[model samples]
Target: MISTKRVFTSSPFMMLICGSLILALALGFRQSFGIFLKPMSLDLGYSRETFAFALALQNLVWGITQPFTGWLADKYGASKALLIGALAYMLGLFFMAKSTTPLGLMLSAGVLIGIGLGGSSFAVVFGALGRAFDPSKRSLVLGIAGAGASFGMFAMLPYGQFLLNSMGWFGALIVLSITCILMFPLSLGLKEKKIPLKEKRDTRAALTEAFHHRDFWLLGLGFSVCGFQVVFILTHFAAFIQDHNLPLTIAANALAIIGFSNMLGSCLAGYLGGKYPKPYLLSLIFFLRAIVITIFIFCPISQTSVYIFSAAIGLIWLGTVPLTNGVLASVFGVQYLSTLSGIVFVMHQMGSFTGGWLGGMLFDRTGSYQIIWITAIFLSILAALCYLPIQEKPLNVLKATMQPIDKA
Candidate 1:
C-alpha cells in the first residue's frame, strides 16, 4: 500500500533540496556579477554603460524567453529544460571568458547566459514544484525554494570578489563555467509528475484570461518596481560604494549582508505568505524597502550606514517572491501558474533593463547616481500604491466550471 503521506512529504522534501541547490548556484553566481564589472571593463577597454547595456540586454532576454521556457516546463518537464539551460550556461561562461570584444561579451553574457538562466533558474524549477506539492503547501514550498536564491546571492558575492583578486576576470569566469555543470543532476530531482487530478485547463485560455485581468497587470506593474529596485542595487551598488573612496570589501560585504538578510527574510515571508493576505504583505515589503532606501540615502554615507541599509533592504529583498507567487496561485489556479507568472516576469525584466542600463547611462551623462537612487524610491512608493487595489479572489471562470460531474 502506497502511503500517500510518506510519498507527499518525503518526495516534496527531496525535490525542495534539489531545487534549492540548483537555484542557489544559478542565482548566487549571477548576483556576484557586479564584482567583475570594473575588472572586465578595465581589462577589455569598454565603458561602464557598454557593460551595463549588455546586462540590461541580458535581463530583457531572460524576460522574453521566460514565457517559452515556463511553457516548456509546464508541457514537458523541468529536467529537459534544465538540461538545455546547463549547456548554455557552461558555454556562455566559456565564451564570456574568452571574449575580448564588446559584441562578443554581449553575445556570451547577454544572450546565451540569459537563455541559460531563464530555463534553469526559478521559473522552470518552481513551475515543476507547483505541480508536485499540494495546494496547501504550494506557497510555502515555493518560498523555501525562493530562499535558495537569496542564499546563493549571499554566498557568492565575497567569493566572486576573491576570485577576481586571485584568478583575474577570465579565470574566474572559467571556474564559474565549470561549477555550472552541477545543474544537470540537481535538476533531475525536480523531474516530477503532475499532482493527482487538480484541474486540466487550456494554457491558451489561461493566457487570454490573465491578459484581460486588471489585477494581473497591477501585479505585473508592481513587480516591475521590484526588478528596478533590486537590479540597480545589485549591478551598481558596489561600484557606487567604491566611488565613495571606501574599501572594495565594504561593498562586497554590503551585498553579502543583503544576501544573508534576504535569506532570512525570504524564508519568513514564505511562511507568512501561507497565513496572510499576500497582496498586503507584498505592499508592506515594498513600503519597507522604500523606507530603508530613503533613510540610507538621507543619512551621512559611511561603512556603518551602508551595512545598515543592506541589512534592512535584505530583510525585504526576495520577501516579495513568495507573496507574488502566492497571489498568482490564489488568483489563477496552478495549472498555468508558470506561464502566467512568466508573462508577469517579462514586465519585471523590462524594469530591470531600465534600471541596469539607465543607471549606467545616467552616471555617464551626469556623473552621479543620486538621480537613479531617487528614482528607485519613487517607484517603490508607486508600486506600494499599485498593490493595494489587487483583488486576491479566484478567477470567476474557475469558479463556474470547477464543480464535479452530475449524478445523472
Candidate 2:
C-alpha cells in the first residue's frame, strides 16, 4: 500500500470538502461554455466550426498539459499547480471575453483555459485525495468529488444562461473570469508533502510499468469514449436544441436535470465500485449510455423528451471519472496517481477534440446532428467492450523479484 498517512495532515472529510469545491468551480464553469456558443457566434460573425474548434483545441491543450501539471502535483504540491492553473484560467476567461476573432478565441479559450483545466480539475484534486485516503475510502471520496462537478454543472448551467440573458456573453465571461480567482485560496486546502513511497519506483519506472500494462491502455481507450460523448454534448447540445426550434430554457433546464441526476449516479457508482468490480461497473455504465442514446435519438424531439434524455444521460454522466481514476489508483498505487491519471485523461481529451470539432463540422455540412449522435452510440458500445478485458489486479511493487509486466 502507498504511504497515505505521511502526506496529508488534515482530516479526510475536510480534504473531500475542499477538493470537491475546487472540482465544482473548475468543471462547473467549464461546462457552462456551451451556453455561449450561439450568442458568441452570432455577435462575432464566426461560424459554428470556429467556435467548436476553439473548444476542441481547449480539450486538446488540456490533455497535452495534463501530464506535466499532474507530475507537478505528484512531485511538488497540488496547491502550486492549482495556483498556476487558476491564474491561467482567470486570464483565459478575461481575454476570452475580449476576443473578437477566431485566433483570439483559440488563444484565450483554447490554449490558456486548457492549461488551467489540466492543473485544477480532477487529476490533481483526486490525486491529493487518493494519497490522503486508503484504498477502501478512495473510490467513495472520488465519487463524492465527482458529484461536485455534477453539482457545478447543475448550478452553473442556469447561472451561465442567466448571466448571458442579463449581462450578455461578454460581461458574463468577465464575471466568470472573476469567479476563477476563488480557486487561489481553495488551492491551499490541497497542500500535501511529497512523502516517498515504501517501494521506491521513480516516475519513469512507474510510467513505463503502466505503459506496458494492457489494462492501462484499455482504460484510457474506454475513457476516451466518455470524453467524446460529454464534450460533444457540452459544446453543441444547446445548438442542437436551437436547431429543433426549442426555446433555450428547455436546453438549460435539460442540462441542469442531467447534472442533478448525475450527482446521485456518481455517488451510487462510487458506492457500488467499492463493493463490486469497477471494470464491470464501468462496462455497464457504457452499455447503458449506448442504450440511452439510442432511446433518446429514436424518440420524438420534445421538451419532455429532452428533459428525460438529459436526466437519463446525466445519471450516468461522469460516473466513469471516479471509477476510471479509482482503477488507476487501485492497480498502480496512489504515489503517481496524478501522473498516470493525467496520461489517461489525454486519451479522453483526444476523443473530446474529435467530438467537439466533428459535431460542428458535420452539422455545418449536413445541417443535422444525427451523424454525431449515431457515432456516439457506436463508440459507447466499443468502450463497453474495451473494459471487459481489463484486469484490475494491484501491481506487486514490493516483490523480491520483478514479475514480467503484462503487455497483452
TM-score of each: 0.93, 0.96
Any residue pairs clashing in model 2, and if so which?
A: none
- Which one wins on lDDT? 2
- For residues 1-408, could you state the per-residue lDDT of candidate 2 as single tens digits? 343223765677888888898898889989988889999999999999999999999999999999999999888888888998999999999999999999999999999999999989989998889988878988898999999999999998998889999999999999999988889988878877655457656788889988877788899999999999999999999889878889888888888888899999999889998999999999999999999999998988988889999999998999999999999998898888999999999999999999999999999999899999999999999999999987777877423233446556
After superposing candidate 1, which stretches have Cα over 4 Å from the reference? 1-10, 194-200, 397-408
User: What's the C-alpha lDDT at position 310 in model 2?
Assistant: 94
Where's the lowest-lDDT run of ten residues in candidate 1? 1-10
Q: All models: lDDT?
A: 0.83, 0.90
Model 2: worst 10 consecutive residues (lDDT sum): 397-406
Strongest candidate by TM-score: 2
Candidate 1's residue-wise lDDT over 181-278, tens digit each?
89988887877544444344567778877776778888999999998888888889988998888988899999999999888898888888888888
